[model samples]
Target: MIANPSDVRNLLESHYFLFAFLSSLGTLQIAVTGSGIRALWLTPYRRVTRWLGFVCIITGVLFFFGQPLFVDGPWAAGSVQADSTTRAWGVASWDELAGARNVNDIHGGLDGVDQAIWFSLAAIIAFSVSVVFGALSIKANTKELRVDAKLDDDDIDGLAGLVHRSYFSNLPISVRNFRLEARKFWRDGVRSADRWSLIKIISGGSNQ
Candidate 1:
């Protein structure tokens, strides 16, 4: 339950809190399942997870904006002029309880509605931006992994050479010479048949 809901700030805060909780759950679900969208079972619904994330954000915004309208209406508030029947049941209407205690609070000095509206907009914008970036990252990573998986030994060696040139360009000559000598020594040691066989065994039989 929320305390001081008569204050629109508290009410909006409660709505925002609930939105955060539900959005977190939605994000977690997307994280767990988004990568598997290409799998056999999930391939059919590949776009669904992405759309669901958008829906969660939009729903949260709607809930935030709709609360004020609903709370002010007479049907939602019930009658202040209750008759004998209403009292006979011992049930209190919304007006009998709080009577819209701060009826003008939402429109008054603090700019509470404006603050909540802006906050909800910011939250939605942040969520949308994060989702877009996350999706792009997932796509880039997946493409990179696929390219790496398709690379042969020559391609890998060429990449290693490129890396060595770029990374060691500013190194001292002595340091580069020492690294080359150490690599040569290791390669020479591993060239022995017995040592090579042992290395193959240790490396799960992969000669590379």
Candidate 2:
């Protein structure tokens, strides 16, 4: 992530600043949830928020790592400017330069990285936005349970522990809880589908 002063300055001056800011926000959300500190979360639905964070990180990593395919950098194909038109127009030929850029075109000049950077940058933005949506959509627990009512289980689920205790004591349990919640969500969806099918079948039989 380290860069020269000039690159940093350029990034700040360009739209890339928004990209970087969004990515940083996403990374920060992941850090907060992964560390098991729920106090800072916008909503009380821990499972939904954590899942959103998980998806965000996974997407960001994939897009960032897949830059070689989407990005037409110096190492990309047709980067050497093999012909006069390519050298002059930075495209394969004058026809390509005159025509709209094709979806398959990869020799888009020195600004290739600019075109491709949006994929990863968008992923970064998606990550941050997903968690916020999760927070907004899920309902918070209505009952005001005591923070340390059940220190081991409740404290892990509750927002009582400070940073150190939250990290060391609750992280493992938090991850496990997320897994359980995922399984439950999947099962619930399947069950609902089955019930809908049964209802449809009964209605069809009565109509016949």
Candidate 3:
């Protein structure tokens, strides 16, 4: 069956970002992952990153507009899709998303596949931002790995953040893989930090 993007969009605005942010670590991952810190703004990938960032921001806005629709279908389509309370904010926004439909009695917006388009547009934006940043972070980590030098303490913090960002970038793309890497990053960070802490404690530093 064709997926209903409207439903998906609603989920995103309602609580998905909270999950995404917690699970993925947002933009910090990208900065830490890339050697582009050397020339981040002018890095070869910077141009692409900026555009994707723009798209990500736009997608967030689009989802804002499309939200009520999923919550409230247009009248022409049927009666209140939502309960009485949601009718206030939801119906108006739903009609607006439907694009100048006779919303007086029309509560529902575009029906069937049309309901999916707005959300799909948002998806395009989501993909660009998350994937672009995620990939860049991965490349940076790989580059560091190739060097085989332990990241300095500050760099380790950066790596921790980068791992989180990579987590987010991976969320929508491959949730399973994202979780795996996230576990690795968190566990590794803890182990590394613990080891350092132990050394410092032996040398008279705080034992944790």
Clashes of each: 0, 0, 11
Checking candidate 1 for backbone clashes, the offending pairs are: none
lDDT (Cα atoms) of all candidates against the true structure: 0.43, 0.44, 0.42
lDDT of 3: 0.42
* Model 3: per-residue Cα lDDT at residue 107: 29
Q: For residues 140-178, could you state the per-residue lDDT of candidate 2 as single tens digits?
A: 331332343554443344234423232334446666777
Number of the predicted model whose TM-score against the real structure is largest: 2
Model 1, range 1-208, lDDT digits (tens) per residue?
Answer: 1123234445545665556644653564365345542211111243665566667656766654444445532213343243212211122243454432232333221256654665566557555454444444344445443565432232222223221122122124435666777898788865755445866779787555
Q: Model 3: per-residue lDDT, tens digit, 1-208?
A: 2213354334333433433332232242244224443212212354565554445445545554454455443321233343322333323344344441222212233444543554455445544455564555556656654454433222333324334334443334454556667999899988778767856778876545
Task: Using lDDT as the measure, name the better of candidate 2 and candidate 3.
Answer: 2
Residue 66, candidate 2: how far off, in angstroms?
A: 3.0
User: Which candidate tops lDDT?
Assistant: 2
TM-score computed on alpha carbons, candidate 3: 0.30
Alpha-carbon lDDT of model 2: 0.44
Better by lDDT, candidate 3 or 1: 1
**Predicted structure 1, TM vs. truth:** 0.29
